[model samples]
Target: MKIDIVSVFPEYFDVLNLSLFGKAQAKGLVEVHAHNLRDWTHDVHHSVDDTPVGGGAGMVMKPEVWAECLDELLGLDSSTSESTTEVDDVSTDSTAAPVLIFPNPSAPLFTQRDATELSHADHLLFGCGRYEGYDARIPEYYRAQGVDVREYSIGDYVLNGGEVAVSVMLEAITRLLPGFMGNADSIVEESYTGANALLEHRQYTKPAQWRGISVPDVLLSGDHGKVDRFRRDEALARTNEIRPDLIERLDCASLDKADRKT
Candidate 1:
């Protein structure tokens, strides 16, 4: 997969080269490029923001700068802003058209399901807004041009800029790509994964007893069936107590008699 990230503080992503993500890049599982948004500016100061039109506290990122950067990255002609082609729905096929994403505080919350969906895209272009945020028309214009533009909020709170949000989202999305992890099954049963979207159950390592706290006896019994049942019940109870919203969104049809009782 190819990822293009535009940010004024491109150096912030240097950490991407130090972890499992670095390994993924080395293995050719993904490619990431961080571009300085100011590189697209033509002025002496290379300014990328301006005062808000209506009256705002902070400066808003200029749309023209973003447009030039995004146009080049997306391979779109700046002259064809009126393209009337229909935008395609997000698909799981890696050959699908590229996805344009902007991190917005007011947008729908980004979830693991979104991560799973985006992992299939062939290319992803992210525009990280600074100061007050980029002009809203940037995404609107792209959508009009038939781009599959997406705006997502990583959480309910606000941040100084989109760089951190993009980092969080990028890690979530890329780790799901094929060959990104050593154990594929580990991703399947993770919390907020699959259809359940429940919080993951607690885990314990060897030495069973730690700091006087003993691991669950079921885990040591060597009975896979009983162990699985114990973990399922624990997950159900934990999710109900910690994140009832996930339980409320659960599909009734997906729950079996055993799950229902739990």
Candidate 2:
């Protein structure tokens, strides 16, 4: 998969080169490109933001800068002097144009399901905004141009900018890509995954007898069926205690007789 991140602070993404994603990039399973948003500016100052038109307290990112950056990345412009700044490694799959995502606090909640869906995309473009945010008209205009524009909010709170949000989103999405993890089974058993969307069961490792605590006998017995049942019960209990909202949304048919009786 190819992901393009356009942000004024492109250096912030240097952390991406540290873990699972770094290995994925080394193997050519993922290609992540971070470009400086200010490179698209037209003036000497290379300013990308301005005072809000309605006299707001914070500045709003200019739409023109975003447009130029996006157009260059999409390979829609010709006869441009900023050839050196153009994105040359973009995918040309032609099945679909890259999905443009703007992280904000007002959009629909981003779920693991969204991450799974995006992991299949050929390319994704993230526009990171600073100050207040990108001009509202930018997304609208992009939508009018047949681009699949989505605004996603990671959580209920606000951040100083979208750079951190993009980082959060990239980690979630990239790890789900095929061959990204050593154990594929770990994906299906994780929290917010599978049909029930239950939280993961608590896990314990070595030193099972530590401090008067012991690993469950069912887990040590090597009885696969009983172990599965124990883990499911623990996951259900944890979900009920913490995020009961997820349990409420589960399908009635998915619950077993024991679950229903409980």
Candidate 3:
């Protein structure tokens, strides 16, 4: 995958070069570039934000600056006419055109399913908004140009900038890419993954007994059937207690008699 991030504080992403993400880059599994949004500015101050129109507290990012940067990155001409069609979802085909994303606090929450879907994209361009956020027309204009524009919020809270939200989303999306992790199976059974979307059951390592707390006996019995059942029940109970919303969304057909009992 090819990722292009536009942010005023590009240096904040330097740590992307230090962990598994770095290894993915080294192995040619992904390519990432962070660009300073000010580079697109023409003024002496290279200013990228201005006081909001009508009335507002913080400055809103300039649309002209974002348009220039995004146009160049998306390979679109500055004067290109807008298309009538608009895309509503990210295309899963790796050969599809690049998808444009913006992190917005009022947008739909980003989920693991979104991560799974975007992992197939060939290229992703992210515009990290700052201050009061970018002018709303930026995404509207792109959508009219037939770009697969997506706006997502990581959670319910607010942040000072989109940089951190972009980081969180980028990690979630990239780690699901093929060959990004050493153990692919680990991704399959994780919380919010698979058809069930339940929270993961607890895990224990060797030296099962510690501080008078012992690992479940079923885990040590060498009985695969009983072990799986115990884990499934625990997963159901945990999700029911902590995230009943996920449980409520579960399909009736996906749950067997055993799961229904849990």
Candidate 4:
């Protein structure tokens, strides 16, 4: 996959060069290009933001800068630029890889499902904004242009800018890509992977006798079926204790009587 990140503070993404994202690039699974929005500026000031027009407390990113930078990155189909899209499979062709607008309190909330969907894209462009955020005209204009643009939020919180939010989103999505993690099995057993959207139950490792509490014998009985049942029960109990709403959302058809006991 190819990801283009447009941000004023391109230096902030240096962290990407040292972590799992860096490893993914090295292994040829993904490529990331971080562009400095100022490179597209026209004036001596090389400014990318300006005071709000109708009366606002902070600055808004310039629309012209976004247009120029994004055009240079994801240019028109007729452009002769070196940048081009190539998908290996028949299913991926002719799709406009989306540019995600980070979700915020004022917009729709982002979710794990969104991450999964973006992971399959051939290209993804993340636009980072500070101050009052990018001029509203930018996304509006993109929508008019028939671009695949949408907003998503991480949580019910305010982030300083979309740069770090892009990083957070990449980290969330990249780990799900095949081989990005050390143990693939770990993903299936993790919290929020299956019917359970709540945290997984507590796990006990050796020393089995730690702090005068014994690990459950069912875990050590060498019975795989028993272990699976024990784990499922623990998962159900933990969900009921902490997030009953998630349990209620789960399909009860799969639950045996033992699972509903709690």
* Candidate maximizing lDDT: 3
TM-score, per-candidate, Cα-based: 0.90, 0.88, 0.91, 0.84
Model 1 CA lDDT for position 97:
74
Query: What RMSD value applies to candidate 4?
Result: 3.2
lDDT of 3 by residue, 1-262 (tens): 8899999999998999988999999887778999999999999999999999999698999999999999988879656555622253333557458899999998999988888778888889999999989999999999999999999999999999999999999999998887788888637734465456988889999898999999999999999999999999998999899999998888777788998777
lDDT tens readout by residue for model 4, 102-153: 4333567665666766666767888888878878888788788877787766
Regions of candidate 3 where Cα sits further than 4 Å from its true position: 78-93, 186-191
Q: Candidate 2 residues 1-262, lDDT tens each?
A: 7889999999999888888889989888788899999899989999999999979698999999999999877655675554544253444432345789999877888888778777667788999988888899999988998888889999989998999889988888888766889888537734465456988888989776999999988888889988888998998898899999898888777888777655
Off by over 4 Å in 2: 78-95, 186-191
Q: Rate the local accuracy (lDDT) of all candidates.
A: 0.87, 0.83, 0.88, 0.75
Clashes of 3: 0
- Return the clash pairs for model 4, or none: 103-152, 103-153, 110-153
Q: Is candidate 1 or candidate 4 better by TM-score?
A: 1
On the 0 to 100 scale, the lDDT of residue 145 in model 2 is 83
In model 1, the clashing pairs are none
Tens digit of per-residue lDDT, candidate 1, span 20-86: 8999888877778999999999999999999999996999988899989998888786565545332
Q: Which rank order by TM-score, best down to worst?
A: 3, 1, 2, 4
In angstroms, give how far residue 20 of model 3 lies from its true place: 1.0
CA deviation > 4 Å runs, candidate 4: 77-83, 86-99, 103-105, 186-196, 252-257
Q: Model 1, residue 122: displacement in angstroms?
A: 0.5
Model 1 RMSD in angstroms? 4.3
- The TM-score measured for candidate 4 stands at 0.84
